[model samples]
Target: MRHGKTFGLSLFLLAAGTGGALAQATVVTPLQQQYITAYVAQNPVPAATYGSEFDPTVGAVVPETVVLNQFAVRQEENRNWDGGQDAVRSMLYFVTPTQQTVLVEPGTRRVVYVMR
Candidate 1:
């Protein structure tokens, strides 16, 4: 009975820790959103043509055929826009046909954020 109680407590703690990590996932702030919008506007790139099958939501994997552009953070803009988070600096972005800017993780090709 004591062992069972210990196991249950351990499981609960593990689950709580996992939840905390998930909650810490990067979130784009309003300022960052504005910066992204302006950046996309200032620098136009060819939009990727993905049919209806493409899912732009977070956690969705981008197809290999689609090219991901490196998000070049200029020194002047980096300090103002990044909010001290290096995640923004390392991400890759691509514009969709609908003009939505999607940030992606380079390694996994997973969509991190889609700015409409």
Candidate 2:
């Protein structure tokens, strides 16, 4: 009887732990979901490092044309860069010409992450 009780308690604890972990999962926004759908359609076979969460190799060039094409008038409203000297603390999402998804810091206008 003790063994059975211990097994049941163990199962309950395992279930509760897994449920909490899943509940804390990141919620992707609607725009991000849209970008994911489009990006996946083009990139069927993902690279080894694709969608890695800890990537720190965002390039320095944040092109005006790419930003203009994806974010049109929104960029004008979100232009918080003053003389382009400060580091961007906020993240913005963009889809590249080749259908790659990226997160960028608007204040610095540099790519901070890529999800491919």
Which ten-residue region of model 1 has the weakest summed lDDT? Answer: 3-12
**Candidate 1 structure quality by residue, lDDT tens digits, 1-116:** 34334333433343354433342254666656776677778888999877689877766779988888876777787566534235455668999888889987676677766786
CA lDDT, every prediction?
A: 0.66, 0.40
lDDT of 1: 0.66
The digit string of per-residue lDDT tens for model 2 on 14-49 reads 335443233222233344445345434644433223
Model 2 error, position 100 (Å)? 1.0
Distance (Å) between predicted and true CA of 109, model 1? 0.4
Q: lDDT of candidate 2 vs native?
A: 0.40
TM-score of each: 0.69, 0.33
Q: Which residue runs of candidate 1 sit more than 4 Å off their true CA positions?
A: 1-25, 79-82
